[model samples]
Target: MTAWVRGRVQGVGFRWWTRARALELGLTGWAANLRDGRVEVVAEGPRESCEKLLAALRGGDTPGEVEGVVERWSDAKRSMVGFVEK
Candidate 1:
Protein backbone atom coordinates (compact mmCIF):
# COMPACT_ATOMS: atom_id res chain seq x y z
CA MET A 1 0.00 0.00 0.00
CA THR A 2 1.05 3.57 -0.73
CA ALA A 3 -0.28 6.72 0.80
CA TRP A 4 0.36 10.34 0.04
CA VAL A 5 -0.48 12.59 2.92
CA ARG A 6 -0.86 16.35 2.68
CA GLY A 7 -1.23 19.26 5.08
CA ARG A 8 0.92 20.21 8.07
CA VAL A 9 2.95 17.03 7.84
CA GLN A 10 6.39 18.19 6.99
CA GLY A 11 8.86 18.97 9.80
CA VAL A 12 6.42 17.61 12.30
CA GLY A 13 7.87 14.15 12.96
CA PHE A 14 5.19 12.60 10.84
CA ARG A 15 7.61 10.19 9.24
CA TRP A 16 8.96 9.12 12.57
CA TRP A 17 5.51 8.65 13.93
CA THR A 18 4.57 6.68 10.88
CA ARG A 19 7.60 4.49 11.26
CA ALA A 20 6.73 3.72 14.81
CA ARG A 21 3.19 2.85 13.89
CA ALA A 22 4.27 0.70 10.99
CA LEU A 23 6.81 -1.13 13.05
CA GLU A 24 4.30 -1.71 15.76
CA LEU A 25 2.01 -3.18 13.20
CA GLY A 26 4.74 -5.57 12.06
CA LEU A 27 4.97 -3.90 8.67
CA THR A 28 8.17 -3.36 6.76
CA GLY A 29 8.39 -0.24 4.63
CA TRP A 30 9.33 3.42 4.70
CA ALA A 31 7.84 6.81 5.10
CA ALA A 32 9.43 9.61 3.17
CA ASN A 33 8.99 13.33 2.76
CA LEU A 34 8.27 14.43 -0.75
CA ARG A 35 9.65 17.59 -2.32
CA ASP A 36 6.13 18.91 -2.65
CA GLY A 37 5.46 19.01 1.11
CA ARG A 38 3.70 15.71 1.25
CA VAL A 39 4.63 12.51 2.97
CA GLU A 40 4.66 9.27 1.05
CA VAL A 41 4.26 6.08 3.04
CA VAL A 42 4.82 2.60 1.73
CA ALA A 43 4.07 -0.57 3.60
CA GLU A 44 4.26 -4.28 2.96
CA GLY A 45 2.62 -6.73 5.30
CA PRO A 46 -0.58 -8.49 6.08
CA ARG A 47 -3.55 -6.74 4.60
CA GLU A 48 -4.98 -6.20 8.07
CA SER A 49 -1.86 -4.47 9.30
CA CYS A 50 -1.65 -2.27 6.24
CA GLU A 51 -5.26 -1.33 6.64
CA LYS A 52 -4.63 -0.46 10.26
CA LEU A 53 -1.79 1.81 9.33
CA LEU A 54 -3.92 3.48 6.70
CA ALA A 55 -6.65 3.98 9.24
CA ALA A 56 -4.24 5.56 11.65
CA LEU A 57 -2.91 7.83 8.98
CA ARG A 58 -6.40 9.19 8.44
CA GLY A 59 -7.64 8.72 11.97
CA GLY A 60 -6.71 12.23 13.18
CA ASP A 61 -4.14 10.97 15.66
CA THR A 62 -1.00 12.07 13.92
CA PRO A 63 1.39 14.80 14.97
CA GLY A 64 0.15 17.42 12.51
CA GLU A 65 -2.97 18.32 10.66
CA VAL A 66 -3.91 15.94 7.86
CA GLU A 67 -6.02 17.76 5.34
CA GLY A 68 -6.04 14.94 2.85
CA VAL A 69 -4.67 11.51 2.05
CA VAL A 70 -4.45 9.77 -1.29
CA GLU A 71 -4.15 6.03 -1.04
CA ARG A 72 -3.20 3.34 -3.54
CA TRP A 73 -3.05 -0.39 -3.23
CA SER A 74 -0.68 -2.50 -5.25
CA ASP A 75 1.29 -5.68 -5.02
CA ALA A 76 4.20 -5.47 -2.63
CA LYS A 77 7.49 -5.47 -4.45
CA ARG A 78 10.20 -4.75 -1.91
CA SER A 79 11.77 -7.10 0.57
CA MET A 80 12.03 -4.52 3.28
CA VAL A 81 13.34 -5.51 6.69
CA GLY A 82 11.88 -2.83 8.89
CA PHE A 83 10.00 0.38 8.76
CA VAL A 84 12.05 3.53 8.37
CA GLU A 85 11.73 7.26 7.98
CA LYS A 86 13.41 9.01 5.09
Candidate 2:
Protein backbone atom coordinates (compact mmCIF):
# COMPACT_ATOMS: atom_id res chain seq x y z
CA MET A 1 0.00 0.00 0.00
CA THR A 2 1.00 3.60 -0.64
CA ALA A 3 -0.08 6.49 1.54
CA TRP A 4 0.29 10.21 1.28
CA VAL A 5 0.11 11.74 4.72
CA ARG A 6 -0.69 15.39 4.90
CA GLY A 7 -0.52 18.21 7.44
CA ARG A 8 2.50 19.10 9.52
CA VAL A 9 4.21 15.99 8.25
CA GLN A 10 7.55 17.39 7.24
CA GLY A 11 10.51 18.68 9.28
CA VAL A 12 9.31 16.81 12.33
CA GLY A 13 10.93 13.39 12.12
CA PHE A 14 7.87 12.02 10.42
CA ARG A 15 9.93 9.91 8.02
CA TRP A 16 11.93 8.37 10.82
CA TRP A 17 8.82 7.74 12.84
CA THR A 18 7.27 5.97 9.90
CA ARG A 19 10.39 3.89 9.36
CA ALA A 20 10.42 2.80 12.97
CA ARG A 21 6.75 1.92 12.98
CA ALA A 22 7.04 -0.01 9.76
CA LEU A 23 10.09 -1.85 10.99
CA GLU A 24 8.31 -2.74 14.21
CA LEU A 25 5.51 -4.19 12.15
CA GLY A 26 8.01 -6.16 10.03
CA LEU A 27 7.09 -4.24 6.91
CA THR A 28 9.38 -3.34 4.02
CA GLY A 29 9.23 -0.21 1.92
CA TRP A 30 10.19 3.43 2.05
CA ALA A 31 8.98 6.78 3.28
CA ALA A 32 9.97 10.12 1.83
CA ASN A 33 9.11 13.78 2.00
CA LEU A 34 7.38 15.22 -1.00
CA ARG A 35 7.96 18.65 -2.45
CA ASP A 36 4.38 19.54 -1.67
CA GLY A 37 4.99 19.22 2.04
CA ARG A 38 3.60 15.76 2.47
CA VAL A 39 5.01 12.40 3.42
CA GLU A 40 4.74 9.56 0.99
CA VAL A 41 4.96 6.05 2.35
CA VAL A 42 5.06 2.76 0.53
CA ALA A 43 4.87 -0.43 2.54
CA GLU A 44 4.28 -4.06 1.81
CA GLY A 45 3.63 -6.86 4.24
CA PRO A 46 0.74 -8.67 5.78
CA ARG A 47 -2.49 -6.86 5.09
CA GLU A 48 -3.13 -6.49 8.79
CA SER A 49 0.27 -4.94 9.38
CA CYS A 50 -0.19 -2.44 6.60
CA GLU A 51 -3.55 -1.46 7.99
CA LYS A 52 -2.04 -1.04 11.42
CA LEU A 53 0.59 1.30 10.01
CA LEU A 54 -2.12 3.33 8.33
CA ALA A 55 -4.01 3.62 11.60
CA ALA A 56 -0.91 4.67 13.44
CA LEU A 57 -0.21 7.31 10.82
CA ARG A 58 -3.70 8.68 11.30
CA GLY A 59 -2.99 8.96 14.99
CA GLY A 60 0.39 10.62 14.54
CA ASP A 61 2.44 11.21 17.66
CA THR A 62 4.61 14.15 18.66
CA PRO A 63 6.41 16.28 16.10
CA GLY A 64 3.66 15.59 13.60
CA GLU A 65 -0.01 16.17 13.16
CA VAL A 66 -1.81 14.05 10.65
CA GLU A 67 -4.62 16.03 9.09
CA GLY A 68 -5.43 13.47 6.43
CA VAL A 69 -4.24 10.25 4.90
CA VAL A 70 -4.69 9.20 1.30
CA GLU A 71 -4.09 5.54 0.68
CA ARG A 72 -3.81 3.37 -2.42
CA TRP A 73 -3.69 -0.39 -2.29
CA SER A 74 -2.01 -2.58 -4.82
CA ASP A 75 -0.65 -6.08 -5.22
CA ALA A 76 1.96 -6.74 -2.60
CA LYS A 77 5.42 -7.02 -4.03
CA ARG A 78 7.84 -8.73 -1.70
CA SER A 79 10.68 -6.84 -3.33
CA MET A 80 11.46 -4.52 -0.47
CA VAL A 81 14.02 -5.79 1.99
CA GLY A 82 13.61 -3.36 4.85
CA PHE A 83 11.92 -0.15 5.74
CA VAL A 84 13.77 2.95 4.68
CA GLU A 85 13.56 6.71 4.89
CA LYS A 86 14.26 8.47 1.66
Candidate 3:
Protein backbone atom coordinates (compact mmCIF):
# COMPACT_ATOMS: atom_id res chain seq x y z
CA MET A 1 0.00 0.00 0.00
CA THR A 2 1.15 3.47 -0.97
CA ALA A 3 -0.70 6.35 0.63
CA TRP A 4 -0.11 10.00 0.07
CA VAL A 5 -1.40 11.98 3.00
CA ARG A 6 -1.98 15.69 2.89
CA GLY A 7 -2.75 18.63 5.22
CA ARG A 8 -0.88 19.60 8.40
CA VAL A 9 1.22 16.48 8.29
CA GLN A 10 4.73 17.82 8.32
CA GLY A 11 6.76 18.69 11.44
CA VAL A 12 4.09 17.24 13.63
CA GLY A 13 5.28 13.69 14.29
CA PHE A 14 3.08 12.28 11.55
CA ARG A 15 5.85 10.07 10.24
CA TRP A 16 6.61 8.78 13.71
CA TRP A 17 2.98 8.04 14.36
CA THR A 18 2.68 6.28 11.05
CA ARG A 19 5.71 4.17 11.77
CA ALA A 20 4.27 3.15 15.09
CA ARG A 21 0.96 2.22 13.52
CA ALA A 22 2.62 0.27 10.75
CA LEU A 23 4.79 -1.61 13.21
CA GLU A 24 1.82 -2.40 15.36
CA LEU A 25 0.05 -3.76 12.31
CA GLY A 26 3.06 -5.98 11.58
CA LEU A 27 3.83 -4.11 8.40
CA THR A 28 7.17 -3.31 6.88
CA GLY A 29 7.85 -0.11 4.98
CA TRP A 30 8.65 3.57 5.34
CA ALA A 31 6.77 6.78 5.89
CA ALA A 32 8.50 9.72 4.32
CA ASN A 33 7.94 13.45 4.08
CA LEU A 34 7.79 14.83 0.59
CA ARG A 35 9.10 18.25 -0.32
CA ASP A 36 5.68 19.32 -1.41
CA GLY A 37 4.33 19.06 2.15
CA ARG A 38 2.83 15.63 1.79
CA VAL A 39 3.62 12.43 3.59
CA GLU A 40 4.16 9.32 1.53
CA VAL A 41 3.53 6.11 3.39
CA VAL A 42 4.45 2.78 1.86
CA ALA A 43 3.65 -0.44 3.60
CA GLU A 44 4.10 -4.08 2.66
CA GLY A 45 1.94 -6.70 4.35
CA PRO A 46 -1.31 -8.55 4.24
CA ARG A 47 -4.25 -6.80 2.65
CA GLU A 48 -6.22 -6.82 5.85
CA SER A 49 -3.51 -5.17 7.90
CA CYS A 50 -2.94 -2.56 5.24
CA GLU A 51 -6.61 -1.79 5.20
CA LYS A 52 -6.55 -1.37 8.96
CA LEU A 53 -3.74 1.14 8.67
CA LEU A 54 -5.61 3.02 6.00
CA ALA A 55 -8.65 3.15 8.16
CA ALA A 56 -6.63 4.49 11.04
CA LEU A 57 -5.09 7.11 8.84
CA ARG A 58 -8.49 8.41 7.85
CA GLY A 59 -10.19 7.75 11.14
CA GLY A 60 -9.36 11.22 12.46
CA ASP A 61 -7.33 10.03 15.43
CA THR A 62 -3.95 11.17 14.35
CA PRO A 63 -1.73 13.98 15.61
CA GLY A 64 -2.15 16.25 12.63
CA GLU A 65 -5.11 17.00 10.47
CA VAL A 66 -5.47 14.48 7.70
CA GLU A 67 -7.31 16.40 5.07
CA GLY A 68 -7.15 13.49 2.68
CA VAL A 69 -5.51 10.20 2.04
CA VAL A 70 -4.95 8.87 -1.47
CA GLU A 71 -3.91 5.27 -1.44
CA ARG A 72 -2.62 2.92 -4.13
CA TRP A 73 -2.53 -0.81 -3.87
CA SER A 74 0.03 -3.12 -5.45
CA ASP A 75 1.72 -6.45 -5.09
CA ALA A 76 4.04 -6.83 -2.11
CA LYS A 77 7.70 -7.07 -3.02
CA ARG A 78 8.96 -8.69 0.19
CA SER A 79 11.85 -6.26 0.21
CA MET A 80 10.95 -4.15 3.21
CA VAL A 81 12.18 -5.04 6.66
CA GLY A 82 10.76 -2.97 9.51
CA PHE A 83 8.65 0.13 9.38
CA VAL A 84 10.57 3.37 9.61
CA GLU A 85 10.10 7.11 9.55
CA LYS A 86 12.01 8.64 6.71
Q: Choose 2 or 3, whichever is better by TM-score.
A: 3
What tens digits encode model 3's per-residue C-alpha lDDT throughout 2-70?
A: 999999999999999999999999999999999999999999999999999999999999888999999
lDDT of 2 by residue, 31-78 (tens): 999999999999999999999999999875735788999999999878
In model 2, where do residues sit more than 4 Å from their true spots? none
Point out the higher-scoring one by lDDT: 1 or 2: 1
Give candidate 1's whole-model lDDT: 0.95
lDDT of all predictions: 0.95, 0.92, 0.95
Better of 2 and 3 by lDDT: 3
Order the numbered candidates by lDDT, best leading: 3, 1, 2
Give the least accurate 10-residue stretch of model 2, judged by summed lDDT.
58-67
Model 1 CA deviation exceeding 4 Å by range: none
Residue 50, model 1: lDDT of: 96
* Candidate 2 to truth, TM: 0.95
